[model samples]
Target: MSITPTPRILVLGASGLIGRFVTDDLRQRGCDVVGVARRFSGGQRVSPDDLELPVMAMEASALAELIRARDIGVIVNCLGVLQDGPGSDTGAVHRDFVVRLLSAIRQSRRDVRLIHISIPGNETHDRTAFSTTKREAERLIAASGNPHAILRPGFVIAPSAYGGSAMIRALAALPFELPEKERARPLQPVAVEDIATTIAWLAARPLDDETTKAVTWDIMQPEPVTLGDVIDRFRVAFGTAPQPRITLPKLLLDAGALAGDLISRLGWMSPMRSTAVAELRRGVSGDPQGWISATGIVPKRMSEVVGARGASIQDKWFARLYLVKALMIASLVLFWLVSGFIALVISFPATTAILTSRGWPEAFAVPFAAITSMMDMSIGVLIAFRCTAATGLVAGILLSVGYMAGCAILTPDLWREPLGALVKTGPAIVLMLVALLTLDNR
Candidate 1:
């Protein structure tokens, strides 16, 4: 079958995972693509060579000028950074550059489709100064009266030309402590391709169709996992049994996070800051179903991007996988003990729901909760004693996975979307992992 003619699309931040995926997807779809970056190799309009450059040069001031000069039809602004530091640049791109570009687009005869990728978080996604700036940019886009879409992508994990992910994998080869929140808190890790497809769906969306109208959409991993689940996956991927470690009382790290944000405000940016600690712990995120309903693209499984991290979970033995699982569960029990009963009461159902959905009935609905609920205050005492951690974790994982497997065997894949695996169901699994891992860690 013949393909439809693709539009002329321009991507800023062309070196980023989202940007790169957007670049490749657009090119594959036959869109005429012009990439922009501050220090693009050979300093040319086209992508550079074998080393696989991130199109660095597009950060240049002349980038918008290039877009207008080239008569670009669509602009995807994947331009953003986590902090206010030197390398963590986004003020201009998010605030000034976008305003300037949209204004310029307004002056032109051809209507431009503007897609801005933003996240709603400050230090760790709770809407800090960094997040505020993005909100400002989004407001400007909406007020500009241009055809635009605001895409707020959740945590993105993709392969990079840079060595950050590799370093983590290398570190995993040795015994090291994973982050505290990583052990317990829920995570919404997303595949890069998923983000790309969502953007493309918006970018190439027909202007006349209400479905394509530019609006704000949250792009998230269909399923979220806990730090423990991710670490277990990490261990599996790297083929290691390294003991993970971490500290509690997360606020101790806040000062560093705040400082990092200040630093990122001025420089290239470091991904590790106290803010992430906060996010991991909180597991704050919105549902992506609205976007999926409107745009028709769901995120790829977190496992797909495991390749980007160079970590494979498919090979690890259950024992190795279960250790982090143990630690993670212990951690959650600690958090609940620390947070007290209200938190525990609210958290347990969702946590158990994760187990139940999989195939583990005791883990899921009745007898387990009934048994736990029936236990007196002394039961909490027994849980805190530590002797029960291993048995609890083992029983939980088996019941959960077993039930999930049984259903998968009996049901169709379509019916399995929300029940199959942590990676299968969407963000809930990530939360379940967090609750369980922390309880194990405790």
Candidate 2:
């Protein structure tokens, strides 16, 4: 299927992770692409010097305006969300959004073709927040009686999203040690480009064919890989240490689910509910036979995409590996710097007080005097916070405490109380925290 260079296109949610790439793909392919976003249109206004594309930065109401104004032939509802944010509800994300967008499209004179990207198992209770809401949106689309193509994509785990976030990147880096029972279930992971390619291919197909086409397609890499196996490959690909992957029993999982809910309420990342836990544990068995028999679009495996580039996003995993290494190094450097600051803050002031009170500058005092004594005992208040919060608070403490300790060491007998100082240490505290909140540290 070949599309002309200038098929007037309108892409909603163009600023998002996938939408940005999809728009870039269409524009590069010579499709007259216009991005509809909340911000200014993304690329250069379609010009000789610039890729000169038009991006409409407007709310949904404004998008309705673009539909009427541009005579847009196709409307790609690329809007979706993940991660933590004020407006990140998956239910409202699509349920309301799809209802509004579809209505607008139907009302428009342009026989607008719609390409909606959906994740697989969207209707399953075991499905995560994204899957559940997206599933609902799909049902609404079917009822819309409008021409539409719904694509159920697998784990995109792109470098951009995966690299910037903690959980996804950590998942890719760590090797799984799942219990034998848990490992029985399977997951067929796909690369990010597979998504871009899927869209490009679908974009080229006639809307008539696409509309009467399959309601859902299993979009993934040709070869299916298990969750545990990918971790091993990730170790070799990134040259990182094997991570601990433990599978908890129902009893432990139930306890964790409760804890996760409580923490999320306090604005901490919560663990999955029992339903979600079951979905992850069970996953999907066998190849999604229905998906393949429908679209006939085979996805590229991670192995194929290791060095491949898609639209605007690079095989950023390669670069992302570097990013991870850099961040780890940077975090270590900040840790030490803060430790030094802590010593300055606590030790220096306490030493001065001791010296004035004792009227003694013990010659060997610096090494003998400990700085931890000068640290305010109150810093431990951070222990009550969730993992992310705890790390930030503890990081601040290390810097402040280390500075105090360093200063106090200069004059030992007066400021340093070895017995009192022995209780608090920057390194020891950080390590203890790393052990306590395994989710937050990485």
Q: Which number leads on TM-score? A: 2
Instruction: Report the poorest 10 consecutive residues by lDDT, candidate 2.
Output: 48-57
* lDDT scores in order: 0.56, 0.55
Model 2: lDDT equals 0.55
List all candidate RMSDs to the true structure.
Answer: 22.1, 8.6
| Alpha carbon deviation, residue 306, candidate 2 (Å) | 5.8
Backbone collisions counted per model? 69, 31
| TM-scores, one per candidate | 0.58, 0.61
Error of 1 at 336 (Å): 48
Candidate 1 lDDT over residue span 175-290, tens digit each? 65555544666656666677777766666667666666657877776676665665556565666655654443445456646754553443313344654544445563556778
Give the alpha carbon lDDT tens digit for every residue of 47-112 in model 2: 332222232223456556668887677777777754333434666666777877776776665666
